[model samples]
Target: MNNEITDSGVATGLAKILADVAGRLAAAPLSARDPLHVPAVATADARVRGMVLRGVDTTRWTLRFHTDSRAPKARIIETQSAVGVLFYDREARVQIRCQGTGAVVRDGAEVDAAWEAATAFARRCYLGLAPGAVTGRPSSGLPDWVEGVRPTEEQLLPARRNFAILSVTVDEIDWFTLAHTGHRRAVFRRDDGWRGEWIAP
Candidate 1:
């Protein structure tokens, strides 16, 4: 019995070390030119098709992504705030899945601040037609307003109606690590105030 307990302790310690390494790898920045530097939002469609929507991480716990106000996912979010965000590092073979509730920021300084940080290219996604509008075949291409015009900061200021900010509050995180010895899984559940513990990896 004593030997079994010792073996379990050692395994748990190794799992903790592996989990730490994996977490750091997933949080590390992507390549200088990699567009995925920002966090990606995972949304589930009717057929369970998982779509990753990329967005910038405002801070460690907060992420900001802009979607057309008319997008179907926006409405889905409004009705159902629960979501899952997956962050993984292939080299490290570590993946972190966060399940949480999301809320849309509508007014006040937070919305204004998010708007200020948005790039012209990002803001361009909301211009012209509404989200999910039908597109008919054109002889040439999309109109000049859609294809040619890029909105300046001034042009985007009043267009806030089409912009939205989603805030996800993480409640649980599942950490998985792949190592030569074996696979390790740890589930971290939030406790009162601030505390966490590793259970059965």
Candidate 2:
């Protein structure tokens, strides 16, 4: 996600590998806009929805993604903060699963700062009239301007009201690697101050 979550030693190394794998897949050829390249986010009600990997904050042990406040997953977090995110890249044979507390930020210093960092393309994601909106017709329901042309920063401004940052403050991380020689598995936890272990695959 944003700049690859630079870090150090084991933690940094592992995060970098995961980021690289996800990046490759996310960058693969597809439509102008595709959610297939994104990872999955699990809500409290057992709903697993796709979401782009917006950013990763390794220092804070949190993963970030942008979404509409009206989205079902967004509502689920308001009541149940527990959330899970899964990242898997078949080509790289790596899977990164994280369980964490969910936080919905609509307006705040963090939100503003994050929004500011978003590129025009990134901000374009929020161009919909309403994410998860019910419509009588079959369509993406995104505003017309988004499909025809790149909305200017001014046009993208209204999205701020609907834009939300779903930040996952990870408490645990399960990493698995599938390999012919030998599979590797590990678990990292924030409990008792950041504990890690090599577990059986």
In candidate 2, stretches whose alpha carbon ends up further than 4 angstroms from where it belongs are 1-37, 119-127, 143-155
**lDDT (Cα, 0-100) at 15 in candidate 1:** 46
Off by over 4 Å in 1: 1-40, 43-60, 138-143, 193-201
- Candidate 2 per-residue lDDT, tens place, 3-122, comes to 223234466655555555345433532332433347788988999987776666555767777788878888899999999988776767878788999999999998998788878776
TM-score of each: 0.69, 0.73
Deviation in angstroms for 111 in model 2?
A: 1.6
User: What is the TM-score of candidate 2?
Assistant: 0.73
Indicate the residue-level lDDT of 5 in model 1: 17
| C-alpha root-mean-square deviation, each candidate | 6.5, 6.4
Give Cα distance to truth, residue 7, candidate 2, Å. Answer: 22
Cα lDDT listed for each candidate: 0.56, 0.73
